[model samples]
Target chain A: MTLLEIMVVGVLGLAGVGMYGLLISRNLIKIVVSLQVLVKGAMLALIAAGYASGHINLAQSMAVTVIVADTVVAVIGLALAIQVRRRFGTLDVKELATLQK
Target chain B: MLNAILVVGAVVGALQAIRAKRLLVSALWLAGCSAMVSILFYAMDAREMAVIELSVGAGLVTVLFVFAISIAGEDTSDVRAFVPKPLAWLLVLISIGLLGWMIIPTIGAPIPGVEPSFSEILWQQRGLDVIVQSGLMFAGIVGLLGLLADAKVPAKETAAQKQAATSIPPPPKALSQSPAIREEAHV
Candidate 1:
């Protein structure tokens, strides 16, 4: 396989692992970690797409935008996790559902 | 060859991040993965992005995760997943397969060109996106402040309130002793 193929595989693998992590993890912090992984895969894909299209500059700019957005997501998710733990006394998503009743 | 190695390292790091028992360990693995991704970006000729990813993805984000873990507790206990493990794995595999099939055909050899400067593309072509991103950042800062302010009620205070509410109160004493009460006491 070529270098581009390798990068594509890496992107797919990372995204898959991230999704699996999100699906299986119960801890809020772990969920955040998975989300970070997922976003990294997306960033890689953006850059790769740019390289393919001979628009590296455009791609890099978009990647930068994604990075900023991702940071905001991570910060907000962490903040929400902290608040959930404080209010509910458990970090488990399953336990947090008890609040509905 | 180096790119392949870096990609493998990144994937492994991500796997470890997901599988680690402790939240802190998972966070550390995520940082390692981010570091590898930054190096990959540098190799791909996106130097500015590499630097930003190194600092923001590996550095700032990891610090944030650590801070959050410290405040929220490690949460080391093994909890059951909402979906069964086998089902989750199958779903992920199917999704990845579909994505790869759809995307692989579109990839083509990169056409060489006299590339424009990064700043030119960002400022001239993507100016609107940058402005929107700035707004998003400001909003995120404001939202984070709100969350922190809302969470400022001390845990100890809530616990104290609960204790006070649950504790039995002493019975009130009668004002001036009545004659019948005094006689009954004497008897």
Candidate 2:
């Protein structure tokens, strides 16, 4: 197996871990953070595939697209975070779930 | 040696982001993961991608996360996490299958023949996709600007906080548990 293959596998593992953390965490901030980690891992896996091919055009372009999408998600998450802070005095996802329930 | 380093760093960073209780520390770890991925990009010869990954992922996004975390405040001990055992096992099996399927086609394909023409495909067949993607990026930037335009810091104090600041105030029954609230008091 090539070094690039290992990297791709490792990145996949990292992405999985990030997703798991995000899924299980109830803290609003941690959920947001886990999401960030998820984005990072996803980007890495995609870009690693591009790199393994030794091609610049597609890989770089893919990274740009991913980053832009992530930025939008991050902004919306922040807005929600602020709203949660003001309305409930806490950002715990558990509390938010309770409130919703 | 280089790929090994990048892989290790990425693994460490991932663990840190998951485990770190402090939001700032999590952000720091997030940056580390971003940096590792950037370096991995370079190793794969996509220099342009490496630069974008570092600059955007580590620099801009990490700062954005830190800012959001600070604004959200911390009295969030009520949060909980639970994962069903059956679901986790299902995830493991699916991921393994995905790995086998994706890795095989990606690597087993002819490199020079299959991939050498990718640039032409990117420009010709995928041209519209690229343009639409760029438009999406522009829309995101504009949305972020709109958010920055309407932000108010809440006058550094709420009514409850002001009452506490002025009069005898409520006892600090939850100072340690509620740093975000204490932040309002100080502000």
Q: Which ten residues in a row have the lowest lDDT in candidate 2 chain A?
A: A51-60
Model 1 chain B: which ten-residue window has the lowest total lDDT?
B169-178
Superposed by TM-score, candidate 2 places the C-alpha of residue A1 at a distance from the truth, in angstroms, of 4.9
| Candidate 2 local lDDT, residue A91 | 71
Candidate 2 CAPRI category: acceptable
Candidate 2 lDDT, A19-85, residue by residue in tens = 6776667666677777877777777767666655655456666666677778778777776777777
Cα-based lDDT for every prediction: 0.90, 0.72
Estimate the TM-score of every prediction. 0.85, 0.73
Query: DockQ values for all predictions?
Result: 0.66, 0.33
Model 1 docking category: medium
